[model samples]
Target: MKVTLRTDVLTNNNKAADFNRELFESTKTLVVNIMSSPGAGKTTLLEETVRALAKKYRIAVIEGDLATERDADRIRAMGARAVQINTHGGCHLDARMIAATLGELDLDEIDLLFIENVGNLVCPSGYDLGQHHKVAVLSVPEGNDKIPKYPQMFMRTELVLLNKIDLLPYLDFSVEEARKDLSEINPESTLFPLSARTQEGLHEWFSWIEGAYVRCVRQ
Candidate 1:
C-alpha cells in the first residue's frame, strides 16, 4: 500500500511537471531547478547569479524552504521578482507547488526562473519540478565523499557547482578527489568549483547560463 501510494504521488507530480513545462515553453522562459544540502550556498550562489545577470536578463526566482520567506526576500532585495514557497514540513518542492506559483509570476516578462529547492540531498532528487535544468550545489565544507555517497543526487543533475572553494586551503576537502568521484558516478556532468563570496570561477557558470538561455529561448 505504501509503495502504491508513493507511486501515485509521483505520477501526479509528473503530471503537474508536464503542465509547468508546457507553460514555461510557451513563454520561452528558461527555468533551472537548483538543489543542495542545507548550507551549501544555493541561495548565496543565486544571490550572486541574480546580481550578475539581472542587468542583462529579466530574472525571477522561486525560493522553496520548509519554512521562512527569507530566501525569497533576499532575492527581492536584489531588485528581482521572487516568490517564496513555504513547504512547512515537506522535504522537497513538488510540481504542484511550482504550478501554484506560476500564476503569481508573469512568465512572459521573465527570461530566467531559478527554482531553489528545499536544501536536501535526498528528497529533492526524486521530485520533478518542471525545470529545463537540474543543477546540484556541493560545497567544499561538505567534504569530498558526498558526490559518491549521494549518488542519487549526482546521478540526476547534469551540472554540479562545487561552492566554497575559498575554504579549500584550510579544510581537508580535495578538488581532484571530487572530480574523480563525480567522474566515476556521472562522467557526463561538469563540476564548477567556485565561491559565491569571492566570485571565483563564476564567469564559467554565467557563461553556461548564457548558453543555456540561448538554447532554451532562441534555439
Candidate 2:
C-alpha cells in the first residue's frame, strides 16, 4: 500500500517551514544537513568535526535513523546536545519532524546544528529543512561512480566530502575520477577529500565549517 499524508498535513508543511526559519533566525544557528548513503562515515565525520570545533564553538546534533538512539547517544557522550529522530519505517526526515524538535533544544546556546539525515543516497535531497547548507559525504569505498548514479543528491549539495581517503591506497578509487565526475554533475560545489577516522585533511573541513558559520553570523 502506498501510504500518503492527508491534505491537511501537507498544507501544514508551510507552518513547519515558517517555524524552522524563525527558530534559526532567533538563534542564529548555522544548520547543516549532512547527507550520504549508509556507511559513508556521516557519524564519524560529525564526531571528528565536533571534537575539532567544540572548544571554539557551541555545537548540537540531531541524528536521524530508521530506529535506534545509538547515534544520538554517541553525540551526547561527547558532551554535545543531541536528539535522535527515529523515523520508524520512513526513509527521510521532513521539515515537520525537525520543527517539532525545536522546543527540545535551546538553540540560542548552539552555534552550529548538524542534522545527520537517515543514511540514504536518495529521498533526503527532495526536502528542505531550512538549513543554511547541505553537505554530501561520499566515502572512497562507495566508489567514484556515485556522482553519475545519484545526480540529484550531488547537484543539491553545497559541499562534497570525499571521506575515508586513508583507504584510497587500499581501494581502487580514483580521486581524480571522483573530482571529474562531481565536476560534471556540480561544477560549483566545494570538495573536501579527507578521512574522518585518522583525521587526515580534517583541518580543511573544519575550516570550511568555521568560514560558513562566520558568513551565517554576518548575514
Q: What lDDT would each prediction earn against the true structure?
A: 0.95, 0.90
Q: How large an RMSD does model 2 have? A: 3.7
**Number of the predicted model whose lDDT against the real structure is largest:** 1
For residues 1-219, could you state the per-residue lDDT of candidate 1 as single tens digits?
344444565898999999999999999999999999999999999999999999999999999999998999999999899999999999999999999999999999999999999999999999998999999999998999898889999999999999999999999999999999998988999999999999999999999999999999874
Global Cα lDDT for candidate 1: 0.95
Q: lDDT per residue, candidate 2, 80-134, as tens digits?
A: 8999999998998889999988888899999999999999999998778888899
Candidate 1, residue 142: Cα displacement in angstroms equals: 0.6
Candidate 2 local distance difference test against the native: 0.90
TM-score of each prediction: 0.96, 0.93
Q: Could you say which candidate leads in TM-score?
A: 1
